[model samples]
Target: MAPQIVGLAFGHFALRMNPILLLGALTGAQTVTAAMAAIQERSGSPVAVLGYTPAYPIANILLTTWGTIVVAVIAS
Candidate 1:
C-alpha cells in the first residue's frame, strides 16, 4: 500500500500537488485506523479505537474537499 501510494505521488507530480497530498493523507488514515484496530483487539478496550474514530471520517472529507479546492485554484 505504501509503495503504491508512493507510485501515485510520483505519477501525479506532473499533474498537480494537491492530489499527492490528499492520497498521502488517505493512506495515512487507513494505516492509523488499522493499527488502532489491532491495538484495540489486543488491549480489549475501546479507548484505542475511540482516539481516532471520530476524527477519521471528518478529516477524510475535509482533506478531500481541500484538495479539490487546491486543484481548482491551481488550474485557474
Candidate 2:
C-alpha cells in the first residue's frame, strides 16, 4: 500500500499520469513479494515480480550494508 501510493504520487508528478508507467512504478520486488506470499499464498504475477528484479539486489546490498554500519556504530 505504501509502495502503491508512492508509485502513484511519483507517476502523477513525473510520468505524466501514464497508466503503463504508473503500473511499472508499483513494482517493489522482494519486500512486496514476500508480503504478498504470506498474505495470499502467492508472490504476485511473474511479470510484476520480474519488473523489479533489477532493483532487488542493489537495494538488498545497500540496506544490508547500511544496517551493518548502524549496528557496528552502536556496538562500538
Candidate 3:
C-alpha cells in the first residue's frame, strides 16, 4: 500500500508516470540505501539504522539460502 502510494506519486507528477518505471525507481532507492547501510556496518560507522529496516528481509532471505544447508548438516 505504501509503496504503491509512493509509486503513484512518482508516476503521476514526477517525470513520466509509468507503474513499471516507478517500481524500478523505488527498488533502486532501496538498494542503494541497503548497500550504504552494509558499508556503514562493516566500517563500524554510525548509520541511520532505523531508517533501513526495509532491507533486513532481503538480507535475511539471502543469509538463509547460503547457510541453511550448512546449518542442517551440522545439526545432524
Please write out the lDDT profile of model 2 over residues 3-73, one tens digit for every residue.
Answer: 67776787778767644333433444334555433333343344443444565566678779999999999
Q: Model 3: number of clashes?
A: 1
- Give the C-alpha miss distance for residue 18 in model 2, angstroms: 6.1
Q: Which lDDT values do the candidates have, in the order given?
A: 0.59, 0.54, 0.54
Note the residue pairs that clash in candidate 2: none
The lDDT of model 1 is 0.59
TM-score of each: 0.48, 0.49, 0.27
Superior by TM-score: candidate 1 or candidate 3: 1
- Determine which window of 10 residues in candidate 3 has minimal summed lDDT: 45-54
Candidate 1 vs 2: which has more lDDT: 1
Tens-place lDDT per residue, model 1, 5-71, is: 6755664776554442444344445545665656556666655444355547876887799999999
